[model samples]
Target: MDFKTEFKPLTVQPQEIEGKSFEIITEELGEHPFTEQQYPVVQRIIHASADFELGRSLVFHKDAIEAGIKSIREGRTVVADVQMIQAGVSKERLERFGGGIKVYISDPDVMEEAKRLNTTRAIISMRKAIKEADGGIYAIGNAPTALLELIRLVKEGQARPGLIIGMPVGFVSAAESKDELRKLDIPFITNIGRKGGSTIVVSAINAISIMATALK
Candidate 1:
């Protein structure tokens, strides 16, 4: 005996499928605390991972939404902790706002410096990143060390990014790093726990970039 089910999707059009998905997401995730501006970003995050808990766990600074939008519209650089994030974001949308993604973790110079300092490439790459893009939006999804280093830079008045989207996934310091990020007055978007990844970061950035395109 063979058990097989024949099924067809509700819609074959991409736009309609996305619209149906958003409707389902909204219907299930009712009465969220996020504002009109913040909800879209949260929606994209959930859409990317299909994790309601992760979507609900999102936290935002007072200026986070507007700051992220402004950064993209102003053509500031966007920094990512890993190549996965760099690859996941919509480059065409980001570049439409004159912004571009930068990832330094694999750069030879950053690698060499990390080895010399006996540190993770994440830590050194951040040091280099701040110099190149002072007001960039940082997307850190896979490296807690990178988030910590950027937080340290913020505390020391050495770096001033427009926004930091930090949700590094791990059991070690991911939650702790997000806690530290919230303490700062700077603009940032983060989650409450270790349940984050490159997809979350990419979704957040893509949402913001899409919003920014309205101004262009």
Candidate 2:
């Protein structure tokens, strides 16, 4: 099918989020993207990847999950908590669950700050965050250094495995993080390309939360 990509800008509404649906926040982009024509195909791909969350700004939600599970079935979900990735060394280890592996990237703005900080402080903070996560949700954030640190961690470990989700909210850094994860041959998904905000990250998480709730 010839699917056209839309470029509608969106705003995120945090308080309005519920169950698995988010308020329509793509008004800024107009009828460019997220229209009926594009939602299905985009929904299909996300479903293939087992991503079924919705956002107040953009992305798919609960309805998308039901549609998605019908097609793709054989993957794991990883939740990269906002803090875990920011922390540095011992972030959560959902991959430790031992399955197809899915990753959820958190807020990207936070990482941008870390990236610009002093090298020593940045490393120290990251390391602390990792230790705190110990295998929890932690997005690589928008900081290239943070993503690079994650790459280093993976390379040095040689035992970690699963999908990587880098939701950086910047131009170069977000793209770079996604590239790094791709290089590792780790299946990944991200809103970095759109300069996504925290809402996008939350939307991705909401997708996984659907399955999580279902399994319960």
Candidate 3:
């Protein structure tokens, strides 16, 4: 069979392509469990990672989106457990609101503390982030230990984050950490199973940032 092997050039703006992608994602997700406001956050997650399972796996506290939006609009710092999560976030979008992303896992002090405590750097970093960015948003997408640390600090009355995006992916305590987060009285966005990553966390923040921009 004779076939043309030439590639065709596309003539669509980046924004248009993104808009269409989101449109297709929404259609594919059809009738998810999220509310109208919450659906946007879920959609953004799916858009970022192209993981439609998020539609089913994602779980949100009733006020998670509201809390996230408030924090983003107020320019609250975004504290990430790992550098990957921090790097994946859209800095330009966050900067518009005078907010920025931070990751302490690679800090010298965090390394020293981790060595002394015999724990992961993520856990030590979270402790420092809690003290430095109190009332900010905590996005823990790589280490379950970090999520656990945040929960412990909050319970001990040492940390009070505006919102917690706990979607750590792993075979270890990822699912368990999310369970603990669900029990907290504070607002949070997490998933049901062990299927989450930096992309999911970044998407959640980007979604909130976009929504907040619309309000301004």
Cα RMSD of all models vs. native, in order, equals 3.9, 13.3, 4.0
Q: What residue runs in model 1 are displaced by over 4 Å at the alpha carbon?
A: 1-10
- lDDT (Cα, tens digit) per residue for candidate 3, span 1-216: 987758665844788888898899988888877888888888888888888876579988888889998898888899998888877888887788899999999999999999998999989998899778878789999999999999999999999999999999999999999999999989999999898999889888888888888996
lDDT for every model? Answer: 0.93, 0.41, 0.89
Best by TM-score: 1
TM-score of each: 0.94, 0.45, 0.93
Tens-place lDDT per residue, model 1, 1-216, is 995657766666898889989999999999999999999999999999999999999999989999999999888999999999998999998787688999999999999999999999999999999998879799999999999999999989999999999999999999999999999998999999989999999999999998888765
| TM-score-based ranking | 1, 3, 2
Local lDDT at 141 for model 2: 44
Q: Using lDDT as the measure, which candidate wins? A: 1
Look at candidate 3 and tell me the lDDT of residue 91. 86
In order of lDDT, best first, we have 1, 3, 2
